[model samples]
Target: MAGTAPGAITVALVDDYDVVVVGVATMLEPYRDRVVVAELDTNEPVKDVVDIALYDSFAQPESDHHEVKTLIDNPHARRVVMYTANFHPDLVAMAQDLGVDGYLSKALNARELVEALESVHAGERVISTPPSKTFANSGDWPGRSEGLTHRESEILALITQGKSNAEVVALTYLKPNTVKSYIRGLYRKIDVESRTQAVLWGVRHGFLPDHRRIDHWRGGP
Candidate 1:
């Protein structure tokens, strides 16, 4: 990868959902001078040579998945960072073993997130502290407008992907009962009463993963 401009670290935000990347992009807008979002890719490869490729693990597989390795091997991304709410010790270790430059928590505020990216760009391996259960979620997800919390939205997204309760437990590392509770909560918020109804509502409300990329910053042509 080529060098970035002085005083700015170029970034490629990666996720499977358009809303996920867009939310992170919006959060970084105020700090554009320090972090230039060079690309916003949804289920697409990072085509530009950027200082950092920040992979948001929203409604997607965790760092243990092959997706993380793909980002690490991408010649276009000088460094790859895992930006996720999951900080399981095993997952962090897996990401480190996969050669991720950083493992950041989603609880970080905008300023802290930018600083962490800067640290990674400076060739440091960074890992954030686990967030308290009371910490508010930082970025957006698919069903936030309809009152779904990040976890609830994730459950719905996985459900839309046809994951059973047990599968959700495995993928999210959540207890089976917790997954059931989230599903129940999301069902009420979305005005659905059954799994079929929730899936229908999720499909209509953008729960599916996207398949394109935004090469420019913030809608530039």
Candidate 2:
């Protein structure tokens, strides 16, 4: 459902950790109509050459000149943005010195993130998140049921993406039992005893069944 507008920004979420990559991809799913989150990365140049490439620092530990330079050299990523959790001033400056178009932290919420990307797309240098928050965290998403909790909505979102319990654990970075427990609670709250039923409910409420989104890390060139 990525955008088709002629001026729509094409971007790639590049991270070594598959789970981080998937998590970011999931976070951006609702904005498909505004930006094209291109499926990229391969031996060949990525098919949908992107306007920006968001390099998650979890995948890249260091902000060295050569590291940023390599990303800048990627043909598919015309502009490089160090999308990371690290905000140490020295590291940020080092990255910027290496021609990174934007140095964005993972602390920004989804709305702030899209705004930063849009600003970057418009040729602006965005380097800070809103003053209030210092880390990326999920919202208290209310579910369709009156008693459903935020964690339930989170689990429901993952389930609707066609993720198995194991995949959900990987994406959420949660323990196996913890994920199962959340699933069990969500199942009860959603009034669904089976995965299929839960998925159906999610679909009815606007969550698309994504059988292949799990492979988004491998989707690039």
Candidate 3:
């Protein structure tokens, strides 16, 4: 987390959405002098001494599963945030059990994302949620999906559509806060740490169309 002074914290963004990557990078640009985003992938490997490894929990879970485990296992990668959209309660619990720094949803706003990244990088956990007034019912997501609930599937679907947390909030008509909770749940069930992975996982698992055709945030084509 807070290894040194307020200087560039190495960040790795692992999502499949060019829009998300571009949006996140733009928001982080102001802190470029203090924060450096190394590589952006749907998988892992921005091999340097990275303080924060931010990735999509939904990204190719099978393929990146071992890679993510390896990344988290590395002591050098001190901070880990599972940024994702589609997941189940069990997945979020797993992330907590794994002791990841935090979880983020692409559906979250730029401000929320920056706060989460900064907080995680500083050794704090940032949980993103929409306005409290958005939803009237809060289901016990923990037990909703015996294996993979309908809501979990919906969250994943929105992620593949390139919708931000805010966008998903508006689309689902659920309270922004509820959507955020859904994202958290998804991470635990899928055993991932970020949204980039979520999108990738969707593609790999046939939930989302393969978007490798899009450009990556770190100059990927």
Q: Note the Cα lDDT for every prediction shown.
A: 0.81, 0.65, 0.58
Q: Least lDDT summed over 10 consecutive residues: which range in candidate 1?
A: 212-221
lDDT of 3 by residue, 112-179 (tens): 66667878887787655523332112211222333445456557767866778887765444578898
Model 3 has an lDDT value of: 0.58
RMSD of each: 4.4, 9.2, 12.6
Candidate 1 vs candidate 3: the lDDT winner is: 1
Candidate 3's TM-score reads: 0.49
lDDT of 2 by residue, 168-220 (tens): 66554557998889888888776888999998987776454322221333333
After superposition, candidate 1 runs with Cα above 4 Å error? 1-5, 40-46, 133-137, 212-221
Candidate 1, 1-221: lDDT as tens digits: 23434689998887768788889989998888799887543334444688888888877778346777777766778999999888778888888899999999999999999999999999999999987763355778898888888889998998998989988888888888988988888888998889999889889999988753322222222
Top candidate on TM-score is 1
Which of candidates 1 and 2 reaches a greater lDDT?
A: 1
Best by lDDT: 1
Residue 60 deviation, candidate 3, in Å? Answer: 3.2
Worst ten-residue run, lDDT, model 3? 134-143
Instruction: Name the better of 2 and 3 by TM-score.
Output: 2
